[model samples]
Structure formats: structure tokens, C-alpha cells
Target: MRWGVLGASAAISRRVMPAIAAGGPTTLAAVAGRPQSAARTTEVAAAYGARAHHDYGALLADPAIEAVYIALPNSEHVGWTLRALDAGKHVLVEKPMALSEADAVRVQEAADAARRTVMEAFMYRFHPQQRRAADLLASGEIGDLRVVRASFAFLMGAAPGDIRLAPGLGGGATWDVGCYAVDAAMLHFGRAPRAVRAVLSRRPGADVDTSGTVLLDFGEGRSAVLDHSMDYGPRSWMELQGTHGSITIRNAWAGADEDGTLTVLGYAGTREESVPAADHYRLQVLALTDAARAGTPAPIPLSDSLRTVRVLEAVFASAADDGAAVPVAEEGTG
Candidate 1:
């Protein structure tokens, strides 16, 4: 698969680009950046044997590019994805695929119309540890899942100008890190929450949330409590409480350091398992390519992305109301 990366984003330059170059049957065919960042784009493209385009349109127009990895900001995801699909390119848009569920659904419609393979890039889901956890749950090792608690946060220091803290551009702790916690919960539960209640705190004078804690109810005693913050020190972990046992995952999102670890506690006793150290970014690209080659559906489907955005919308709504529970509308219900 020939992949072109749109935007010389930090994630692209530091992570996904290198992963694509080093992994699987995919080639880093081209890279584009804003017109002002042409020099940087060229430098990065040169390092990867890819063509450099100062304008994103030029990259989309390139006939040699088979797919596009969109590392644009959260607000730009749906628009660029629609354009890429119209340009006859498969797309891998970064997570929180759109700012709202309506936008995500529109993107899905466009992709279906264009018959392109489009996916939200939740790289962590491709990690072996996540796969192993799924296997365990299916095997009834943890019995029936009852409750989930997840947290993903990191101290941003004094960089007020940082994009995560920017007034607009979808800057906020929830949009930045809370999405990961919610996504992980959905991955385990395999269902969208019926209701969500949340409390979000914004930094002084900032319009966006700086931190938030959300509760998702799936009914029948299945629920999740997810917390995220940008003002807090580095912290990431998830603990799933089930009927027979529990599964705890540290470093649930990136897993960039050590091998992914999950510990299980049950009547038999406590046991820990380690999945091989793997580059989730690389794994994501490989999985996309493999699906393309094998004529299979994407590893993560649009329906799943829609569900995630629905939950996100519910959380935001609940936060706006000071933790008043908000009903989540199932996709297509409205």
C-alpha cells in the first residue's frame, strides 16, 4: 500500500511516519504540510524517500498516492476525510474522528458512497495486549464484565500556547485524553452507554475542559467511570472488575515503553501476562494494509467510531449541565 501523510503533524513526524516506513507492505509515498511549513515537510519527506507537497491539495491530487494518513487536528478530520474519499483515496483519520457524531456519520456516508476504506486511527487497539485481553474476556476468564475504571492524563507544564490548551481547535483534556479512556471502555464492553453523566473543569479563562470525570451506564449493572486531565502528572491505567476476576492494564493507550502488561486476579490467584513489545503505530498500518490486501473490512469499523463519538457528545452534554445525566442516542435512532 502506498501511503501519503497529510500534515507534518508531531504524531506523523515522530511516530506514524517512521512506523509506516519500517513496517509491513506499506510505503511512505508522500507528505504534505501547510504552505508555511514547506521546508519542514521537505526535510521529513526526504528522510523517508517520499515526495513533498507544500499544499495538501497537491498531495491529494497525486495519482501515485493510494492512501492517506490524516494527522490533522480534531476539527479538521471530517472535512479532510470527505475530501480524501472524494479524491479516491483510502483514509486513516486520527482519533476522535470528528467533533460530533453527526459529522462522523456524514464522513461515513461519504466513504460508503466512494467505496473507500476509511478508519479512525485508534492505534492502541491494534496492540497485542488489547488483543490478548479480548481473547481472555471471550474465554470467560474474567467472567461477565461489571465495572470499568480508566484514567489517562499527563501534566502539560506551562505551555499555555500548546495546542491541547488552545482556545479553539478542539483543545481540551477530554478531547485530548478522555477519548482514549472512553474508547477503551467501549472496546471492552462492546456496547454504547445508555446514559452518561460527567463533570468537567476548565482552566481559568479557558473555554475548553482541562479535566473531567465521566460515568457511562450500560444498564444491568454494567458501567464505566473514566477520568482524564491535562493538569495532572503522567498517569494511565484501566481496571476492569468482572464477576469471577479482574483485569488491570497499565499504560493502556500508548504502551510505547515496556511490553504491554495485564494482570488478572481471580479465585485461582493473581497472574500477570505480557504481550511482546510492539509499536502500535506500526501494527495499525500493517493491519490496515493486511485488510486491504485480503479484501477484508477494516480492523476498526465506522460503526464503532460512530459509537465513540456518540459517547463523547453525551459526555460533553452532561458536563455542560453540571453532571446531569444525559441520554445517549443510539446511531440511526434519531
Candidate 2:
């Protein structure tokens, strides 16, 4: 598959693109950006051996580009995803697929009608380390699942006008990083959350959250706590506790830099596993190719997205109600 890029944020340009370049059955074909960003994208494309264009339409209209990676701001995900599907190009959009669930569904419906792929890029799930964790959890080494706790945060010491603080841009820790925690918890539990409660910190003039903590209950007496922030030190980790022992994975969410540790303790014994660095984007691209060519399922399916969006919506409702607990229902799909 020949791929094009829709704008290059620091994260996308430096981290994701390199992984895409190394992925199987996929090649970087072109890059599109704002008119003013054309020059930078051009230089990047040249360095990566891809074409470059000034507007989104030009890239979408490019015949050589069979797929496009939407690395634009969060708010642009829905619009561009729908447009890319309509233009006959597969899309792998950055996560928190859209600002709202309705928009996410619209993207999915467009993809279904076109028979094209519209995927949410949650890179951690593609990493081998994540798969290892999943295997360990499924083996019941941690015994019957009970609770999951995860956190992702980093200093946003951003420039005065950085979009991470712009609500209009769909910028916030909840949409930015909390999605990962939520995804992990939901997938690990293999069910949608039953209730959600959250506290979002916001300041005047800032339309997005600076930081927040959310709680998810999956019933069966199981629950999870998720913490996210845009104005804090770097932290990414998770833990799962069961009836017998516990499994702790330090830096669980930061799969790209798998310089983390995994600990499993039980009546049998205790083991510490050192996870080496892995290219999550390469894994993601490979999975996408598998789904497209072999008719394999997406690593993160549309229904999983629906439940996640539902959880996020409930979180918003809870936050809007000043942290009132909100109930979440089971979804028809994972």
C-alpha cells in the first residue's frame, strides 16, 4: 500500500512516520499540509522519499496514494476521515477518533459504504509487549480479574498558542492520552465500563482540560482508575490486580519506548520482565495491511470504538455534572 501523510505534528513526524517507513507492504508516498506548512512537509517528504503537497485535496486526489495517515489535530479527525473515505483512500486516524461518538459513527458509516478502511491509531495495542501482557492476563496468572489502574501524563510547557489547550481543536488530556488508559482497561476487562466518574481541571480562556482523573467500573465488582494531564511530568504506567496476585507493568502505555518493566507475582513465584524498545507504528501498519489484504479484523474494531466513545461521553457527562457518577452500558461490540 502506498501511503500519504496528512500534516506532520512533532509526534507524527518524528515518531510515527519512521515506523510507517519500516512497515511491511506499505510505502510513504506523499505528504499534505497547510499552505504555509508545505515547505516543511516538502523537506520531510524528500528526506523520507515521498511526495509533498500544500493542501489536503491535492494529496487526496493523488492517484499513487492508496492510504493516508491523519496526523492532524484531534478536531480534524472526523472531517478528514469522512473525506478520505469518500475520496477512495483508506485512513488510519490518530486516536480519540473524533471529538464525539456521532462523528466517529459517521466516519465508520462512510468507510462501510465505501468498503474502505477507517482505523483509529492506538499504537500500543500493536506492540509485542502489549500482546505479551494480554497473554499473561488471559492465562489467569493474575487469577480472576479484579481491577486495573492506568495513568498517562506529560508536561505540556507548550508555546502560548499550542492546540493542546484549545477546546476547538479537540485538545485535552482526556482525548489526548486518557483514551489509551480507557482502551487498555476496556480491552483487558473484555467489557464496557458500567459507570464513570471524573474530575477535569480547566482554567479560564482555556477550552480544554489541563488534567483529569477518571474512574471506570465494569461491575462484577471490577473497576479502573485513569489519570491524564497536559501540564505535568512524564508518567505512563498501568497495573492489574486479581483475586490471587497482581501484574504490574511500568510504562505500559508508552510502547514505542518499551524501556519498561513488567512484574508478575503469584503463589507460584514472582517474575520481572524487561521489555525492550519496539516500533509500535510498524506493528500498527503491518496489522492494517493484514486487515486490508487477508480480510483479517482490525486490531481496534469499529465496535470497540463505539464502546470507547460511549465511555468517553459518559465521562464528559460526569465531568459536566461536577464529577457525578455516570452509568455505562454494555455495547453490542468490543
Best by lDDT: 1
lDDT of 1 by residue, 1-334 (tens): 8999998966679988988788458899999999999899999999999999999989999999988999887778888899999999989889879988889889989988897888889988988888888888888988999999999988876575677776568888988899999988988998898999999998677668899999999899999998999878589888889999998887777554568889999999999997777888888888877776676789899899999988898898998898999998876794
Q: Could you tell me which 10 consecutive residues in candidate 2 have the lowest summed lDDT?
A: 289-298
Kindly provide the TM-score of model 2 when superposed on the true structure, using C-alpha atoms.
0.95
Candidate 2 RMSD computed on C-alpha atoms after optimal superposition onto the true structure: 1.8
Q: Which stretches of candidate 1 lie over 4 Å from their true place?
A: none
lDDT to native, each model: 0.87, 0.83
Which 10 consecutive positions of candidate 1 have the poorest summed lDDT?
249-258
What are the per-residue Cα lDDT tens digits for candidate 2 across 102-196?
78778778988988877789888877667878888889878898999888898876568777777788887888888889899998999888899
